[model samples]
Target: MYKNILAAVDGSSHGDAVVEAVASLAKLTGATVQVIHVRPSQVIGGAIASTVVPVEEREESQRVVDAAVARLRGDGVTADGEVDEGLREELAAILIERSEALGSDLIAVGPGHYSGISGLLHPSVSRGVAKISHVSVLLVRSES
Candidate 1:
């Protein structure tokens, strides 16, 4: 029942699964997909310093988005991509905002990879998005 979908990727193996899941769903529902990659910004020097994202980092993020869009298009799914900059902790919010801006009905993201103390220290992006998203969320688990 989805008319538009937003797929978030991190260039990981799980990211591939996310693309695949989105592609299948988009094709099934005739939904257009918008793929996005958020490059984690880092503050230089100190907290007061400006947030900086290296050129290489920005290029890599664009590459991730481009690849996902290409794969979806190759599968005969209409798709486009964009790259955004944000902190790791704010990924969920960024994705949700973009999804709402684009009027997306579904958001597909990869499964969380952290566990134990690490999991507690760093919350999962997918879980965060699912928790607060007004629309449907699909957590694509990697087959590996």
Candidate 2:
């Protein structure tokens, strides 16, 4: 049984499935859920790009966290959320660090969305977390 559950969302279509899976698991285990949305920084014109995410993008990320938290609370599950910024490649490390900081016993995340050649090109955050995490991981596959 997990004491604390870390749920990672990217505001993608798979986000809902991740939240729902976390809710169900938390309800069963009586665990508190901490939802996180990581806003990936992009590289542009051979530059590392700005640290500050666009206002609109930040708002959207907050919305994603808020909605997930609300849905979990509405399900009578204890939950909270946070929005973080990091490079796309560092997403797994960020999630791992956050989860460790919060003492999360389990991490629930969406399935990797990439496929075929594109999948080979882009690293999957979910896969990375699963491979290196010290805690248990639940990959909630969405029907999208």
Q: Which stretches of candidate 1 lie over 4 Å from their true place?
A: 43-56, 115-118
lDDT of 1 by residue, 97-137 (tens): 99999999999999888789968866689999999999999
Look at candidate 1 and tell me the lDDT of residue 119. Answer: 82
Q: Stretches of candidate 2 above 4 Å error?
A: 47-56, 116-118
Error of 1 at 36 (Å): 0.5
* lDDT, residue 78, candidate 2: 95
lDDT of each: 0.89, 0.89
TM-score of each: 0.89, 0.90
Tens digit of lDDT per residue, candidate 2, span 71-132?
Answer: 99999999999998887778899999999999999999998887999688668999999999
| Candidate achieving the largest TM-score | 2
Native-referenced Cα lDDT, model 1: 0.89
